[model samples]
Target: MAGKRGGTAAKERLSRDVIVASALALADAEGLDALTIRRLATDHGVTPMALYWHFKDKDLLLDGVVERVLEGVEIPSYPAGSQPEWHVRLLDCFAALLNALNEHREVADLVHRRFLGSTAGLDIAEFAFAALQEGGFGRTERAEIGVQALHNLVVLVTMEPGERALRDSEEEVARRIREKKVVLQSLAPERYPNIIDCAESLVDKPADEGRYRGLGLDILIEGIRARAARQLAEPAEKAS
Candidate 1:
């Protein structure tokens, strides 16, 4: 009987976590689009039906991969009355998330697409919300800012340059930036004054790009701090 049903027997050595790990490796090497069940089954020396025993559907399989990747992310403990401000703590969390996602470029898209449903995603949301609440933001404001924070994370990982983009030599990067600057500066200043005025910055490698996670998070935290202060002071203006 065991020999008759060879398909299941072939997958006897595979576990759910093993399958998810294999899928994650495949995605890391060749993007998420290449992570199909049939491909994974072949990789694992099993049949598609064997994978079904572990993950009922494709979505479930991807969910497992997401969870596995997220498990590597480190969420720091921000105790009450901590020395660092809440916004700082939030930045730390965001930095950790960016670094974790940076390691797996293929999963960055998946994280952005389905983050709200993942356990690590909710953990990050809860942490940020607590920080916002502590910062004196109202419930509605917290929700709005939370959405923005999540969006920023998605943009940071997906849009920012990855290992592949940075694989070029330093000379190549500088040459590319110089060409971009000249092109931007060559545009008719009469028609586009702003572009001409900021041409140097527009294509400045160090100033305009690179380390997007830090740059973007700095801007976001500053904006949130300013908004939180204004929101806190609104009641005082009304009373006075």
Candidate 2:
């Protein structure tokens, strides 16, 4: 029995992929706070140095985990020549990303804590930049829009319900929605006329989780379109 156990231990070699995947599983099973090099070593039946061989420190390890989560997401690709408007294309991308983030709550939280400068993150950013350029945004404006879209996506995902409530009991979900509506409706109408007037819309039944996000993106796109039109007119005006 001792020899058999020793053989099994000897076979348990570590690789960078295995380490990163284990880290991701750990983060998903427990919260991010529980993820530590020591804990990882224990989980893998290895020494702390074994983990260090793959990741120099916690931050690097986290970056790897984040990249692993992001790898599951696909950036939306628009067809050449006859693509939708830039904002539509942009929304398509954001919608896909938001879906991906929502699927992994822990990963979304991690992404919220650390800016994703990973290769996958850069690729998504490049895609957004191209969309913005197609929309006629200046370099600075494109950068701002890309950053804000990501920020908005993170906020939307983070603020959503803790778990996948689609499979949850309707009674429980309805109770929670009613409670939220009561609080919003009870706010002093004098101070919050808009909130008071739009309570139903604010907390719609069978909640449209993407309602606010869609509306916000619409506003952003419209604003960008207006700005782009103004910029074009200004150049023509100067030429005239």
lDDT of each: 0.78, 0.74
Cα-lDDT of candidate 2: 0.74
Using all chains and alpha carbons, the TM-scores for the candidates as numbered come to 0.80, 0.72
Off by over 4 Å in 1: 4-9, 78-83, 161-185, 193-210
- Model 2 agreement with the true structure over 23-137: per-residue lDDT tens digits: 8887776767778999988987767877787689999999888787677778876568777877777777777777777666666877744555688877777877888898788
The alpha-carbon lDDT assigned to residue 131 of candidate 1 equals 81
Best by TM-score: 1
Q: Which one is best on lDDT?
A: 1
Q: Count the backbone clashes (under 3 Å) in each candidate.
A: 0, 0
- Candidate 1, residues 1-240, lDDT tens digits: the string is 876568656667778888999999998888788989999988877779889988899999998888877777798785677657888877787778777787886787677557667788788778878888899987998888877776787677666532233346777877887788888889998899998898776555333334656788899889999987898899999999
How does model 2 score by TM-score?
0.72
